[model samples]
Target: MDSSLVMIGLTNVLSFNNIACILGGTLLGLFVGAMPGLSATMALALLLPLTFSFDPATGLSMLASLYVGASYGGSIAAILLRTPGTPSAAATVLDGFPLSQQGRAGEALGVSLFASFFGGLMSGIALLTAAPLLGTLVLEFGPVELFAIAVLGITIIGSLAQGSVISGLLSGGLGLLLSTVGMDLTTGTPRMTFDQINLFGGIDFTVALIGLFSVPQALTLIENSHQGGKVASRITDRLMPRWSTIKQLMPNILRSSGIGIVVGLIPGTGGDTASWFAYNEAKRFAKDKSRFGKGEVAGVAAPEAANNAVVGGALIPTIALGIPGSSSTAILLGALMVQGILPGPNLLTDYGDVTYTLIWAVILANIALLVVGLAFTKMSVSVTKIPDGFIACAILTLCIIGAFAINNSLFDVGLMLGFGLFGYWMSKAGVSPAPMVIGLILGPVMETSFQQSMLIGNDSFGVFLESPIATVLLILALLSILQATPFFRWLRVPFKRRLKPD
Candidate 1:
């Protein structure tokens, strides 16, 4: 990165408006994450439409702060209710609730808070260092290479998704099909508009995100409202852990943070995977594994640290290569495109002021996480008190208003509701909507790049094969998909023999 760009970023983040947004976002995230059902992704999706009114840097910084805060806040419900507030907090419940039952709630909360801060801080530093280097390397890519990158993204995300690879790929395909809804760019004729003027420009990505994430979540919360006993535990002891305890766990925290950063670099994996991976590593490294689920502080520290670390780790590819590292980053990338900032390698140079500000915001947001988390960790239980039925109603109302607010079009609102129902159905079918959203985001880029590459290659199909980067990426995409196939074991037979000989 350039010194000038760093200076520009410093100024952008230091502004009063941006600082307020970051702090406010952090508070909101804490509240949302303390609830048992809401996720950082859903919070981000619901709040995305509101960001359009602000400067891109401020809005993005706010969202980044929210991401950092929510990652930590999820640990609260895990400790108190024995239920994870978010999927990423699932591992924390293994030890966190045990501590609460043993009257060490404060100790567990303190460990979680400190671990989250340390992990997020380290990941932010890694993001600051890694994204620019990767950006420079990718700046050489042409339309052919960009198209290849898109193909690689789609395949990798699909293959690694939580369900069957076929389902993932189908979701991605559906998103690509939906992305073609607007008028054709090359020809003035509409492609999939179905004679609706609202579809002329295209489906609003923000509208779709709000509907897909928020509505289903609200509906689920309503369905599960019959369950009770969500009383929050009170923090009676001092919130901070002893310095000796911190020293003892520093190694575990550092190792888990590293694990988080690496896991987050992958496109399909998210904090949930990183947290579980870290928790297992902690157990494996412990002298007495039997203590892991019995109110062990290391168990609490590992998962919280790893999950919060994912914030900065996931942003690297999103900022550097325009390929979202996780679902949360996918929304952030969508917000960028919605704000008229094109996604690609030049994010460091062409949009340095905004991009660099976002980087700085992640670092600062971690710091803010430490301060806000310490002060309000106990007080956040108030948020959990709100009834699920009320939350569902609020979510539905907000989704409708936000969808309409995008273009003041009732058709968009109806479309959002349609996607909401579709999202709910997908959840029942065990399909993740993230891959679909990613495909939707990447579709236009892939199409435009392919068309441009063809034009550059004199309308020859051989153009795709001309670039080495494109060729390598296309091969990787093929390998990614093939690895999920039934014949992959057969394909690995030769490698197995070679490894055995070695």
Candidate 2:
């Protein structure tokens, strides 16, 4: 807020070299994020050493732009291939690929691009103006509240299921079970590693993500080609969505941005949580719920906005409190450390010029994402039309390479193949993998918070009930579960009327 520092910051980032850094890093991030298994964290890590040559402010600006660009890039793969290019893109696959299948790939890409821009811009504004206010909020969330949040996040699997509620529950439970495969965080004992060193860290989420989504689709493409399924040709639909379409999706995009900010501000959760949460809320708010996962633009809009918004939201805590909100932000924090800029409450004060340059860079990068996406989204439609045979091979190679890249372990690759088979079977059984994926994501947060809360309360279950916020969240979670039942749907719950005859 200091005028002198603000002016210095503006001047630093606006320089031609820094602007070029923003553009180049954004382009690099876009390509990296569009590849399955590669992540923003990975890309930033690779780019970190190169920043040593640039001025501190300029180097920070480039990294910030890459972070913003990668947030939008993951949606590209989700739209084209039914595979999440990054973990945060998982929810995008639900609606994006469906629209692509319907030959509306260009429109889907456009919606995702604009939604990401809106969300990222909003998040950047919040970071610029409300960092201190939002940072204070971090203190209010104790372990109990976090556990409640995780519980609420888990319950949304019912909303994501979209087909059979029971099947969704089963899938979510399976995810929770799989999440326990890692070492026991509390006792320092292995729970389900099964004597395999690779299992010591549990399954890498990316490996599972690539295998479950990417491999199954690849295999399916092969099967469809063998069965003589029609291969769609390259589409040439207009990439720029009509103004009317943007107007209709604006509300969903706005709401999803808020969700992303809240979720990202929390230290442990990330964009993946925000995206899925936004997707569920969008479905909950829809007038025609059945349209979800079947080419609905709102479905694409909500997740894209939320996930991209998370980049800005996650940075608030990292900048204001020095607590990294997520892994990508943590790596960004590392970049600051490399430049001798330590993170803490005094971070902005000690290095106001450079820090503010980072903040402004995120805003500028979102604008860059819009420009690049508009020009490239239409061209990206080609990926949706690759011949089935070649597409199948490409997907398989990418998934395998991605899985192996996690730790250079053949075991991870084999695990990915195994999950691919399982995911294929789950698809046949009418079970949605989204819920299971949600379960895997929320499980650690739930387990850790619950255990920590129990320790604080001397093993009393009353600890969860003591907090008003936790109590309300638990009730909402319960409501989510109850509403998913056949009885509630049949009765229509709150709207059911008493018999007039009485």
Candidate 3:
């Protein structure tokens, strides 16, 4: 890396425009993420078209900050309303809402925000140190290894459906089906277009993301608008996490962050899965598991740290191997490609200075998130006070604009509305959209790699088993599925009983 170029890049990011974008993006993400039905995926999709016109560095810097902030922001409502703003926050509501009920809402929110910042910072540092090493390692992968990585990604979908891993697998299968709608990349043959011109390109992932995340949220908001009350009583003081609290949470935070960084290094696991896994593990490891769902501060701390840490974690492969760890970063990767920047080994060799600058940008962006997030924390809470009528109109407008903006195609606008109604129905049925989003993000990667691996092996029936990496991944996937079943819990009872007595 050229020291001068790296210095220049830092100078550029520190400029007023880039700094402002970082703050602005954080604020926007916080607001969207705090809303009960809005999600990080939806916010990213809505903002994607707008970033097209920005400097690649500026655009990504903003999105990166938003990604970090939004993940944290969801914990706010999870604490206050018993409604998680993002699926990653679902575990937060286990204990966060109870804290609010006890008139400790401010304390909970403060701890959440502070923990979020810590996790994000730690992850950023990890990204800076780890991305290059992992990226280079990934370069050794062939189709078999890549296919194994994709299957591991699908395992994350199971975590979202904790009690019924089969349902999660079904959701993933559906996503693979959807990915096949477009023309085949390898053969140029259309398999599932249904003879429609629009279907030739397949459903836009952004459109699906927007609808899957946002529309259901809008319906929930409409239903909940009438049942209103101040969800908090006296706000607690000492918004910052005290040293004692930090000490108590340190072990869990470290554990969860390790989970996040490792999961994030995988090609498709991303932050959402990291958050879920961290939340579950934190619960399992707690000395008093009973305290977990009843307002344990550690519950908020663990996932918050894990998810944000994923930001830096995901960036490792993105910077090193040129593959994205999450959907949001995948979109950013597309933006990089549009700007004619190749991401991968050559990037570090040829433009290590620029890469360092990008790492610096990540650090700067997170600092901005912490500062702006703390400053405007109270204001973000007030957004729920807006009338449902206004939210309906605003969301509808954004839906229209977001859809049309993607490809300047009115057909996409219709697609958004159609999926919007579909999402509404799905929500009413109690099917969380988080699984769907996970499935969608992992689907294409899994399919392409699966097909490619099969081809490389000359379509031999036993090729997957022949590959050690593939066999290990298959075992992990099976284990993940088994862990999600009731049989596993049933099997654990005798082991616990044996440990307890004669």
Candidate 4:
């Protein structure tokens, strides 16, 4: 990295116009993310078109700020209303709402905000340093390796199912099937379009995301409208935690942040996965595990830090390899393409200044999140006070608008509604939508890479197993599958017993 180039990028990020854009974007993100049925990805998708009018640096910075802010903002609703504003904050609801009910809403919010800030700061540092190194490493990867990695990601996610692993696999298989609905990329022949032109382009991801995540929540809200008062009372304490409490939770925050960064670096995984993994790890390692899910401050800190940290980590692959680590970063990649910037190895070499500026923007966004988030904590509590019916109607309206806005097509709107109904049913069946989402995103990559690898190897199946990286990834995938089985759990019990000291 050139020192002069780095300084130039920092200078650009610190400019008044760029700072204003970041601030504005962060504020918008906080509002959107604090509302149930809205997600960071949907927010970015809706906002991407507006960035076309701005300079590249300003536009990208704004998106980065929004990503950072939304990652943290989800906790507000999760804490106050027992509903996560974003899927990434789902784990936060386990402890956050408990704390709110205990009349410690301020304490939970403060810890969440601070942990989010710290995690994002650490991830920004990781993005600044680790991305370049990882970029070089990925240079050694072939299509076979990439395909293997995608398979590994899907396997890991499916195996981590909170309910039946079969259900998770079934959901993932369904997504993979849906991913094949469009025309074949290689043959240019329709597979499952059924004569619909819109189907030729495949289902729009944003439409599916909105329908799957937002619609179900809206329906839930509407169904529960008659039974609810405000989930919690007004919050009226300081919005910052005491220094002593911060010091005590620092270790858990740091550990969870590390977990989040690793998860975020893997393409197809997102903050939701990171938060759940962090929450589980925190519970496993805590001295007082009994406190978890009953308003343990550490419980709130773990997921908040992990989810926020995902913002910077997810950006790493998006910037360096053109592989989006999560849905929000996928939208950021779209924003880059709209600005005529192509991501991959050439991104750093041809657009070093812009790349570095985006990295710096991540750091700046976290700082702004800390400042702006604390300022709004008191006011945001009022969100829970809104009537459930009113909230449901507002969200349904936004969902309609957002779905239609993607391509200005009523067909997309219909698709969203159909998927929304499907999603609601899936939820009712106790199946998670996360594995399906991962399968949907990675299915194309895996298919394309596998075909390309076969072509490169003259139709030889051994090509996939030949690469050392691919081999290792496949082994890990196998292990992940085995780990999800009851037999593996039984086997592990004895090993754990043997390892324990008498």
> Top lDDT: which candidate number?
1
Q: How close is candidate 4 to the true structure, as a TM-score?
A: 0.81
Q: Per-residue lDDT for 1-502 in model 3, tens only?
A: 3457557667877878778888888888888878776767667766766777788778777777788788888887788778777777887888788888887787787778877777778878887667556555554566676666556656655444433566566766666667677788678898787788887887887677667666666677678667665343335555665788888888888888788778877655666688779988998998888888788888888888787788788778667755556666665554454455644444554556556666767787678777877787767777644566567667777878877887899988888888788778766665545455555555665667678888887988577888786788678877877776789989998889989955
Q: Model 2: residues >4 Å from true position, as ranges?
A: 132-235, 380-502
lDDT, candidate 1, at 381: 69
lDDT tens digits, residue span 322-394, model 2 = 5566657756765776677755545667677887899889999999889887876556544434456776787
Candidate 4 lDDT score at position 187: 92
In the range 1-502, model 1's lDDT, one tens digit per residue, is 6889988998999899989988889988888898889999999998898998989999999999998888998999999888788999999999999899888898999999999999999999999999988988766788889898888889989888879999999988888888888977677679888788888998889888988889999999999888764687777777899999999999999999999999999889999999999999999999999998889999999999999988889899888888888888989988899789877766887899899999999999988888888889889867776778888898899899899999988988999999999999999999999888988899888888988998999999788888888888899999999999878978788778988854
Q: Indicate whether candidate 3 or candidate 4 has the larger lDDT.
A: 4
Clashes of 4: 0
Model 4 C-alpha lDDT versus the unseen true structure: 0.82
lDDT of each: 0.90, 0.78, 0.72, 0.82
> Positional deviation of 407 in candidate 2, in angstroms?
23
Please report the TM-score between candidate 2 and the true structure.
0.60
The segments of candidate 1 whose C-alpha lies over 4 angstroms from its true place after superposition are 489-502
Positional deviation of 423 in candidate 4, in angstroms? 1.5
Higher-TM-score candidate of 1 and 4? 1
TM-score of each: 0.97, 0.60, 0.77, 0.81
Predict model 3's lDDT versus the native.
0.72
Q: What's model 3's TM-score? A: 0.77
